[model samples]
Target: MPKSKTKKRSGTDATENRPKRSRQSQGGTPVNSASQGGGDVEARESPLQGHKCLWIMGSSIVHWAERTARLDDPQLGFTKHNMSVKWKGCRGLVFDGLDKLMDSMLMEMPKPQFILIHCGSNDLTSEGVTGKMLIEKIQCSILRYQALFCKTTIIWSSILQRRYWHYAPLGAGKKIEKKRTRVNIAIKSFILKNGGQYIDNNNISAKEVNLFHTDGTHLSSLGNSILINNWKTALQSLINSTPDNSLLTLPTATL
Candidate 1:
């Protein structure tokens, strides 16, 4: 985590003033401070609007989806179909990784109508974890989210297969590549089984040179275009659909 500065003020004064917000890094999480016990404590609020879509993912999303999203070009009209786009991008973070991002950032946030979840790139590198086991963990997490956020629609983006996997030490890269494929299949199945949507990155291909950077760890400019377009397509449909709040009145995963 990056260190941040918090402005201190008198308790009385703090009550009248809204907390200040600052970004942790160039494209990292936003750090905010609220008054607490004569000091400021880091805090976060729901960044999403009541009706906009939220994208929660890791570094690849930071480079691909978020980069396109942050472009303030007026001609682009960042807003799509009345949706206020929000991105929670962190490098090397996963739902179950060291950061435990899902628990810390999402659990208590204001629920949105749509969300795109793409994580587990770092989890693929964890030792002794098989693809099937990883998928099971992710499934349980989604089930909990459904139980909690009944009206919110979740779209799980597949873990992308990188081109540089062959460059990894010994057989690690190859192993990761194979596991990614299996995990993707499992994710798609789980999402559908639980009545969730799965986004299969259409640009994932060996011939898509513009999709990845030199290290094969991040997305190139062209990659961002492809990803953002995909998001727009998926979001348009959901935004146009009539939402049923009672979809998850009971834990559907148990069924």
Candidate 2:
């Protein structure tokens, strides 16, 4: 397993100051953290005001949104959390566990009307996982979520290509990129087939990646803003398409 390059904060700082929260209680099965006031606050205020978009993120998404929330939108009332583990990667067994965790979380909270999923990069980096296996894992995760939360709209973000070779073993990075392309092709097919929506982040530049991170693997404040801008455009389209309650009636996926 690859160790996280990021440093861990002191326990006091972690408990007191972290804005991004896990739905699970510490050492427990994942459950929505309403008592902690860490989920969507907008949903709490009148329930009819803003669209409750739950960002079910991977490590990359967590890295991006944590920086972005602090710098750009402190008032942006959305829930950002991670289920992805570094080096464990996005395999069938990993996603099977994620499905159970997510199912437990949804059962406790009102189902989120909108879900944004950013994952699969780690799956490409894993040694034993194949593109076919990655796709099947994602498919299973999606179907499981759909069954649990029948009305949620899902936005599947495309795996953003690396700005430069960040992985090792000579030709390994290229091979990973090739596999990523195949995984994305499968994701696009599945999204189109299931009436879900896709967001392509491959168009983001190396310069943008640099601005977003000190390292290639994570996002900086600037990088997070780029993500939010891109995602917000897609979200606005969905909000414009129907009334708020109609959002709950929309298909399981929307871009």
TM-score of each: 0.67, 0.64
Per-residue alpha-carbon lDDT of candidate 2 for residues 1-255, written as tens digits (9 for 90 to 100): 124467632211001122232121111011111111112122222143344545444444545464455565532433332111111113222333555545455554555665667776656656577788889888766665555445566567777655433433444655776787888788766764564656665434443434335445555555565555555555545554644323222222211
Give the whole-model CA lDDT for all candidates, comma-separated: 0.54, 0.49
Clashing pairs in 2: 212-219, 212-220
- In terms of lDDT, the best-performing candidate is 1
* Weakest 10 consecutive residues of candidate 2 by summed lDDT: 28-37
The reply for model 1, stretches above 4 Å from the true place, is 1-50, 72-80, 166-168, 171-173, 242-255
The most accurate candidate by TM-score is 1
Instruction: Please give the lDDT score at residue 210 for candidate 2.
Output: 40
Q: RMSDs, each prediction?
A: 16.2, 13.3
Q: Which 10-residue window in model 1 sums to the lowest lDDT?
A: 22-31
